[model samples]
Target: MIETVVFDVGETITRDDRYWAAWADWLEIPRHTLSALVGAVVARGQDNAEALRLARPGIDVAAEYHAREAAGRGERLDESDLYEDVRPALTELRGMGVRVVIAGNQTTIAGDLLRGLSLPADLIATSGEWGVAKPQPAFFERVLEVAQAAPARTLYVGDHPANDVFPAKAAGLRTAHLRRGPWGHLWADTPEVVASADWQVDSLTQLVEVVEDARRSSGS
Candidate 1:
């Protein structure tokens, strides 16, 4: 039986356009420019961090990120950052005795911010804490450990196909692709990626259904 549902943070639960547009506005960069930079990096199958380095050459991206984060320790993500479907779906899953958790490639404060928002996730884990990111085997190992759920019985849901669907499937978890974020829509037409996921959801309403369908189809 599937005992746990692990969700991606940024795009899976949070709305990307709002999140990134605000980020672009703060950095004094045009939203289209920022989006293109992100697309350029992802198009070549590179990590999201590469976008910043490419956008502003010769800058110490990591250092700048840390400095900004350190200065913004008090910053809280606006409620609007979250998708409307997130809470209701999480609530229903938890009510059904499924362990709902959040795990993502994110900064250290992702846990604090998520918790502070009073999100329904029972636990939140991050790449910062693990010192590793998704699409990496070590990260999935940590996810399995922290979740204390077997890979075969865990449902891993995320918006990015490269980092989420493929990797989670390789890690032996049931994979579900959420098709609402930047990466989600960007790679939607990629046949191999679409075919790889055990489930594809346009929204969390569909995501809830995917989980139930997985149980029935897999007989787990």
Candidate 2:
């Protein structure tokens, strides 16, 4: 049975795509260029530090993007109501006797952002504070260890294929791909990528059903 549901914060639990979109707009660069830069760095088989060096320009863009995101902190949006469902979903999962943990590539700012959005603060288990990042296998391993969760009894949910699903599967955890929304553009048309996920959902609401099915099958 899936005893715990681990989530990626940025795009999975919250609608933070505006950060990326702002980066692309601010850099005056195509979104694909940013993607290529990041992908090339990851493909180089270097450590995260080296990847960061290769991706420095994009990082600068990201800083500017975060500034913009921070500036509009209290403005709020009607469509942002999508995020309101997150806390209740987490509450329901906890009520079902399942543990909830957030595993994301965020810095200390993550705590503030979660608080600003009124998300459950206690659920976060991030790499930024832990000094790691996603798709690194070690990151997920750390989260599992910290959460006292076995790989087989945990599910990693995230919006990115490589960053979320790929490494989680490599670490022996089941993965659910949040297929809709802005991150959809990150996916490539490849058979391997397409077949990587154990389950895929277009919305977080759908996750409730997926978890219930898993629970029933496992007789939890």
Please report the candidate that would top TM-score against the real structure.
1
How many clashes would you count in candidate 1? Answer: 1
After aligning candidate 2 to the native by TM-score, how far in Å is the CA of 114 from where it should be?
A: 1.3
Q: Across residues 1-220, which tens digit of lDDT does each residue of candidate 2 receive?
A: 7888888876677665454444555555676665565556545534333433454534653465467667764223234634656777777777777788877887666644555654543467567678888878789879788666789888888877778878999999988887644453446334645687778777666777888999889887
Cα lDDT tens digits, model 1, 86-138, are: 99999988877789889998778766777778988889878987799988988
Give the 10-residue window scoring lowest on summed lDDT in candidate 2: 73-82
Poorest lDDT segment (10 consecutive residues) of candidate 1: 67-76
Q: Which candidate has the top score in lDDT?
A: 1
Q: lDDT per prediction?
A: 0.80, 0.67
Clashing pairs in 1: 1-220
Query: Cα lDDT of model 2 overall?
Result: 0.67
